[model samples]
Target: MRHSLRFKVALVFSALTIVLLVAQALGVKTFAEAQEEKLITALIRDDIANVMQGYRANPALLPPFDARLNGYVSAADQPLAALPGSIRNLSEGTHEIVLDDREIHVAVVPFEARRLYRVYNFSVYEKQFRHVIDMLMAGTGIFALLTIWLAYGLSGLLVRQVAGLARQVKALRLGGSTPINPGKYDEVELVGLVEAFNDYHRRMADMIEREKEFTCNVSHELRTPLTTIKTSCELLEQDAAQGTKSRARIQQIERAADNMRELVNALLLLAREESTQNVEPVRLARMIETALAPFADRLANKGVETVIDMDRNVHVAANRSALAIVLSNLADNASRHTDRGHLRFSYADGWLRIEDTGSGISAHALPHVFDRFYQASPEQTAGHGVGIGLAIVKKICDRYGWPVELESEPGRGTRVSLRLPAAGPGSASPDALSAVS
Candidate 1:
């Protein structure tokens, strides 16, 4: 219905044209043929009978375009292009002759020795078709107009249900739960499809509302414990500075508590990202730097060197905070898993690769490496809080339509690569980065 009026009109006209034109052609042919057959039958039995008998008695040669003995009749405008001349030149009993490259059907019933009656039909159908053609040409335009009008009216009536469905779709787009109330007593299949679409929209609205409520309550409850832990750790840091050589142990405890708080924050951030209500552009390289800032001490403690290689202004489509969580998880996984080996971080060919020199993954565990609760090999599990790191990484890859591949051997080391998918030339999307946490 929203489509242009011209298109609908043109479609209707085209269908009408086919039907009307075919009927016109067939009617012209049938009428013209019947008229020719009637004339031929009459000539053979009635009008030319006496002329033929008179000519048959006088046996003579048939001449070209002979109208007298050969019953050569035609319309007034153009006489039949038959043989021309009289039939008095040569002796003839029964003669066969060609006229305008066509064999004329003829018979000579003898009435005398010198004169023979002859009858011939030289393509009578062709001469009659000319009149039919003229009539059809004169009337086709008027009939075509009538056809379009009648067809358009019927087409409009037939398409009324389609127009109603279009309006229902428009309403659903503007208002998620709007009903598609197109009438459907005769259009059973179309009605079923519209009903299914409305049902899907209703389910989606319910899901989004439920997720919003769950996210708010979970985030609120999580914040309380996080605040308590941060306060107690700050108090402990102040106490250790007062004159306790236990500064090192207290500092270690503070760091661990801070890490736990960051973990809780990451979880909440992940939930918000899944809501997909808000998104913004973020540069992946900068997020990597921010996440690296917190792990400086861990890198030093393990005697593992960290290298960052990337374009200074590389950009990716994402939420800054969500992407930060993603990098934090990946870096933490690399660092914690490596005992005293080098960790390499680099971005190349629209991909980020992280490799750690530590205990290479065991063959049996590689298959489930990214499972939600899978643990790393013993060397990296010192205090691995939860087993969701790689799982989160995998989810992020799926969301962005990226691919994450891991390569490892028993003693060589482990390498994780995140490569861009074949989307049009662009950086990652928000939902993809959000899946990281």
Candidate 2:
């Protein structure tokens, strides 16, 4: 009967009503019983208390009164059974009496003439209890309606906030031009979540734009030298008859061939760096030692000091070919730029730091440092280094989802750090860090 809220709430009101109704009923019953008892007591004291005196004064009238009020007045052999009291004293059962032509309740107690009578009646009290129950029912209905109104109001605010976030997500684009704009919220958690999502979406969009521009430039820049080499080769083949002219043609072809070769080689290295992404666990320390072996004679010739602090069992997962190409480019760039300095490489805690103590990249040149065909100002240029190494390093790092951070000050030294993921984050390739380091 009291399981659900509807039942529970209804029951709660019903129970309260029952308590109040019962109390009212009890109070009225107690009052009615006292009134009934008083009436009976008074009737008995006034009429029956002086029955003997009344009979002596008007002995003839007593016979008529007995005949009128007594239940046992057969008019024959009924004098011995005549009782002194109201008709309510006739029996001990439910009884009805007429009061102004309407029914009322009365219970009579038979007792000695000197003792008082007891009477109890309940009909009058029942009416008051019914009104109390009805009042409670009406109040309970109003309270439930109010609760539902309150719940609806609160749910509206919650639903609106959720709808705003949903619309933002639906409108999200990886490379969209429009930026996200999440407004203020009543709740802090919703605000924080919106901010985080907006930031992530913005970063991804920027990265996509960067890649698109990179692809466009690579195609335009590499195509020019390729076309030139092809044209030069075709002309040389068509004019083989003239000896003097042929010699000059051959010289032109050689220069064109070299330029074309550089373009092709650069493109090939970039492709390799992008395609190779897996690096299993390996002794990168040993690999670094090996990489240094080939550079030793060149370092000594340039009077460059080398310091390496690598873990004894240094292991990192990455595309080894790409990593080695990155290292080699940094090293070669270092050697070419430095007038007199040192280089240090360290691999620890899943990071590889390569510091080159050379004249740092100029502030003006920094923005275009990774730009193709970009070089330091010719007057300040330190060597005949083609300005593509840093760009290549950046592309490779991007393909592998690694980050390369650069720190430099003009005339000071430069530091570059590479972040490597542990082997188990994704798939593993061969033991390639050994080759890469």
Candidate 2 scores a C-alpha RMSD against the true structure in Å of 17.5
Candidate 1's displacement at residue 147, Å, is 5.5
lDDT score of residue 248 within candidate 2 = 61
lDDT of 1 by residue, 318-420 (tens): 5344455567887887777677879887877867888889777888999998899888554458566568878877776565455788999877788888774
Q: C-alpha displacement of 20 in model 2, angstroms?
A: 55
Query: What's the TM for model 1?
Result: 0.58
Give lDDT: candidate 1, residue 378: 49
Cα lDDT over the full model 2:
0.61
- List the candidates' TM-scores in order: 0.58, 0.37
Which of the numbered candidates is closest to the native, going by highest lDDT? 1
Q: Top TM-score: which candidate number? A: 1
lDDT of 1 at 127: 57
lDDT of 1 at 348: 79
